[model samples]
Target: MSYFCGSYPIIEKKALAGQIYSYTLLCPQIAENAHIGQFVQIKAEGYMLRRPISICQTDKEKGTLRLVFEVRGGGTDKISQLGAGDMMDIIAPLGHGFTLSDAPNGKVIVVGGGIGVPPMLDIAKKYGENCTAILGFRSFDRIILDKDYFATGARTVLCTDDGSVGIKGTLAAPLKEELKSGAAAVYACGPVPMLKAAAEEARLAGVPCEVSLEQRMGCGVGACVVCACTVIRDGKKQVLRVCKDGPVFKGDEVVF
Candidate 1:
């Protein structure tokens, strides 16, 4: 995919939750070429390494790209403090994304946990009414983009671990039922445990599944082996870079 690296002015900035912030940037080139599930790497102020955030939303006509992130450390905290009109250095549309081509005709299940929920928004929008989203959060306050998913005409099921909202359990609660209804495909992103469970469920249901992995990265590119993940390819297990080889892989291929 074509990518652009440059400084872009923030057009909008808002806090979605307690420590979660959503920043929209005016970068036409990146907005136009970015695919669903792709991510952008932003250079954190005074930090040597960049922070990779998934592409939350994009508007090619408006020349904007949105990124949602939590203030987890000094780098992300620096990003959360920036206001509109602030210019930030970023490399856009890096890493492989989910494949829509493999999606089944009738309905596709999109699952996300915690921060992973943002990337699923674009996929729901792309699939429209044919998409069914299962989002899990730690609690009510952690919930995000529920309205956004509804606006896209996708059926959404929200769950919280603490039983403070919607269904009280893991995403697997709703996911198991969805799989029983039959789906063309399944796509997910979240913590390793959540992903592993979803992958297993998909396998049992005989549905094709894709998962986006999260890892610590020294470089946004594959030059560093920091984000290496083990995958079963062609009957053999091999280590692949999440940044270069894929942040998205077939659920069955991942070694977990």
Candidate 2:
């Protein structure tokens, strides 16, 4: 993957949910090199460290990159205050992404929960009708990109924890049903618990699965060990850096 550190102009910025903000940036280099599940690190105002946000969408022709993030603390709160026309420093197109080479041959299940839902949008767009998206949120107000997923023409399923909207349950219910029918592959990103459950379901079904992990990152690059996670590689357990080795790994390979 190619990595670029530059000041990108914010083409547009808007609030999607209560504390969630979407920002579109004019970063040609990153836009051209970015893959579906790769992420970018933005330097938040007044914060010494950069915040890692996944790439939601990319327009190579237009040279634009889209990111959706939640305002969780002081760093993200500062990011939420920025508006259009502002320039933001970012290091992008980092880490590995999902594999889509075999998607056209058979049914592919794309699952995401809460903030993890955004990255799944580009996958749906690429795989088109072959992808089935299962998105889970805490409630109606936290729901995001429902229309975007529908626009991709991929079969979409939405789940809400409180039963305020869509199905009254977690993503695991629909995911289990999908696996039973048969799936060639599955891609998931969510909380640790949700990912573990999804991984186990896919494993039990004998289907190939990949998961994007979220971790506390100090440096956006591999210089720091903050994002390390235990993974079984070549039958040996090792601590891998999420920023470099992956944010994405084979479902069966992850120790969690």
Candidate 3:
């Protein structure tokens, strides 16, 4: 896929808990080109490496893309300083995206944990009532986008490790329950353990599954080889660049 590199205006900005932020950028070409499960690389002032952030939402007709990201380190911290009306240097529509569907069944279930929740919002909106979102967070304060998921008209299940809000544990039990009924596919993005569990559940349920990975990246494209992941394809285990080949991959393909 072709990528566009430019400075875009930040049209809206909002801060969420844990130094997490939602910034809506008015980049017509990038918005039109972006896909769900893809990401944007933001060049932070004074940083040699750009920060790779997941694309939270996209409004192509409106020529905007919403990016939700946490302040992880120096690069992201520099980015957090920017707000509405600021020009953000970005290269976007990067990385492989989720396969919307590969199942005969029409319903899909999306699983997200912590900062991983944003991307699932778009998928749920696409599936509407046919989507069930099993979201896991550290605690209530850690929760973000539950309302957004609800706005998508999907059944939203919130699970927190601390039981401060929603269910008292991880997504395993609820996910298993949701799969029992019937689902066309399962999609996930979170920590490796969460991804592994979700993939395992989907495998047991006989559902096609895909997952987005969170990796340390240097170049947001294929160049730097900083974000490498192992996967099995055609019976051969191979190393792949997460930024180029995928931040998204088939659940079965990932070695985990």
Candidate 4:
């Protein structure tokens, strides 16, 4: 399908955290086709370039798509201030999603850090009870959507740099415990550092793993190579488009 750029009708907008906002946009076409880990590029104002944000959820029947974003800079700061009745220009359901075709559906491990946890939520919803979610943040105040994740029926583990939540360390620590026990597969999303650590940990445990990467983009779609990333395939270095080939890729194939 051709990439279509249009305005999104906002149905709901609410604060998720201090500067984080959750927007439920009405987009029947994109919602019907969205997959776990896929994202949409949206503009905060008319005539502005779009910023890519991962799709948090999609309800095709309801014609709604959700996105959770924090006010990290100018783009997101403008987004957080948008109201329910506001209209947003968006191009969505872009990029490749998670590869679940070979997923075992048995004892899956998911690790997320900070805002990176949002994309993993859709994955957890699809896998349900078979998945275990491990999340990390700097502190309790920075934590955003734990309760909803717990409601997914996946065994949820929370970690904070400080001892304010479930665990007092990074996700790798508890993830190691799960791997040692017997996790079938591991999926992760987070800052580059956390993902690097998780990839290394997964390698040591000898478990298959996939990671979702977030990068800056000048154009939300594949037309622009602004989000090109390096990956290794069959011992060869290849450049992949985060907007097209994948935001999700096997841990071993990615270059940390």
Candidate 5:
């Protein structure tokens, strides 16, 4: 709930894919308290509202936070123009993040699709060899973070829509395979269809699951009604704000 708002210096920026870029910022205050699934509200120059970007990785000791984002529109296009050495405006760490299990588990599965892939990195990195990451993309060209996931020492499964990469299909097959072996828990973030399927699969498998909802936010914070999603909490349907209530929620609770 506690957050920081400031202009942080961009330490490094790397081009990941065609329109995707990774930025590392020097922000001690934000990095010091950032959690595995929290995000930052970044100010895009010349734009009225800030864009929400997930915290890809955070190094508390080094006082740095990494954000991987794609140039999706005018606001993000402006954000993409900034390079290393520029001061970036950000308010973080915002929203509820994933409730990560403190101890390492031999069986944990993390799923992500397209732009949703970035947030899964933090959990994969933390769980290391104990985690299995099933990542999906439209094609080989759209794929990002394969090497990065592998570098985390987590078992990485790659899937593409065109079969130009690992497996040509959705994450369903592999997810079911992993669950068959028994998973302690499942975590996911991606397109709603994907999230829904993953949540259902985990539910049927009787594995506890958590999912990060990908929502467009006008205020980044809970002030605006822009990011509302209905979820069944306490056996009742309740409207919730993705920015305030969560980007992360228990899988079965999501109405999607």
Candidate 6:
């Protein structure tokens, strides 16, 4: 059975960062089966394709699912206006998430840039003290979820390009320091540049790393090929759909 088999009612909406909004939807079915790093497809009032959004946090006790997203285009703008009691079509818990077992007891580092931190937040929550969260935004006004990460008791690092919040630099420099200090594995989600830089740092440091890719989707299910991505295996390139194979993939396997 589909987790989001019917329309869900929106319970609340709040701004998390600069131009970023987080919506909490009330759907018992979805809230029950939702997992960390999974996403949902929401059908806009007049749009043809549904907008895919990651599941930020699921509150089973309250039967709510929170989704955080950026307002970069038209589809998201329409979503930002939704208020309490608004109804939406959501198909949830889609795509493969991070492989948590890959790190086990080692120091697991999570790196996020801009809107990418939404998916990794839950992962850090589950890992508890063993997790290290590195969050970066363009400026101070763009930061989100720092307190939550710190509250997890995980060692949290903050960075910004314009010196607005934490360290004033790219995530790579501190990440290199973490790896040198012995972070066993790293997982990241963010812009292509940030993912690439994280992968490079991991490679140089000999740390195992995985990355979650963000791509446009026509359908959250496996039906459409709109979210196609290329992966390199055995020195050959193969095509994979982000909606089906993964929004999360091993950093070394993906072909930029």
lDDT by residue (tens digit), candidate 3, 32-81: 88899999999999988888899999999999999999898888999999
* CA lDDT scores, all candidates in order: 0.90, 0.91, 0.92, 0.85, 0.92, 0.84
- Which portions of model 6 show Cα errors greater than 4 Å? 1-3
Off-target runs (Cα >4 Å) in candidate 1 are none
lDDT for model 5, please: 0.92
By summed lDDT, which 10 consecutive residues of candidate 1 come out lowest?
97-106
> Using alpha carbons, what is the TM-score of model 6?
0.93
- Please identify which of the two predictions, 2 or 3, would achieve the higher lDDT against the true structure: 3
Give each model a TM-score. Answer: 0.97, 0.98, 0.97, 0.94, 0.98, 0.93
Worst 10-residue lDDT window, candidate 2 = 98-107
RMSD to the hidden true structure, all candidates: 1.2, 1.0, 1.2, 1.7, 1.0, 1.9
- The residue-by-residue lDDT of candidate 2 on 28-121, one tens digit each, is 8889999889999989878998999999999999999999999999999998888999998899988998887743558889999999999889
Candidate 1: residue 56 Cα off by (Å): 0.7
**lDDT per residue (tens digit) for residues 1-256 in model 1:** 7788999999899889889988999999998898888888899889988998998998889989999998899999887889998997999888998899644576989999999999889889988889999999999999888899999998999999999999998988799999888998999999998999999999999998999998888787778889999999999999999986788999999999
Clashing pairs in 1: none
The alpha-carbon deviation from the true structure for residue 164 of candidate 1, after best TM-score superposition, in angstroms, is 1.0
Using lDDT, rank the candidates from best to worst: 5, 3, 2, 1, 4, 6
State the lDDT at 87 in candidate 2: 92
Provide backbone clash counts, one per model: 0, 0, 0, 0, 0, 0
Question: Candidate 3: worst 10 consecutive residues by lDDT?
Answer: 98-107
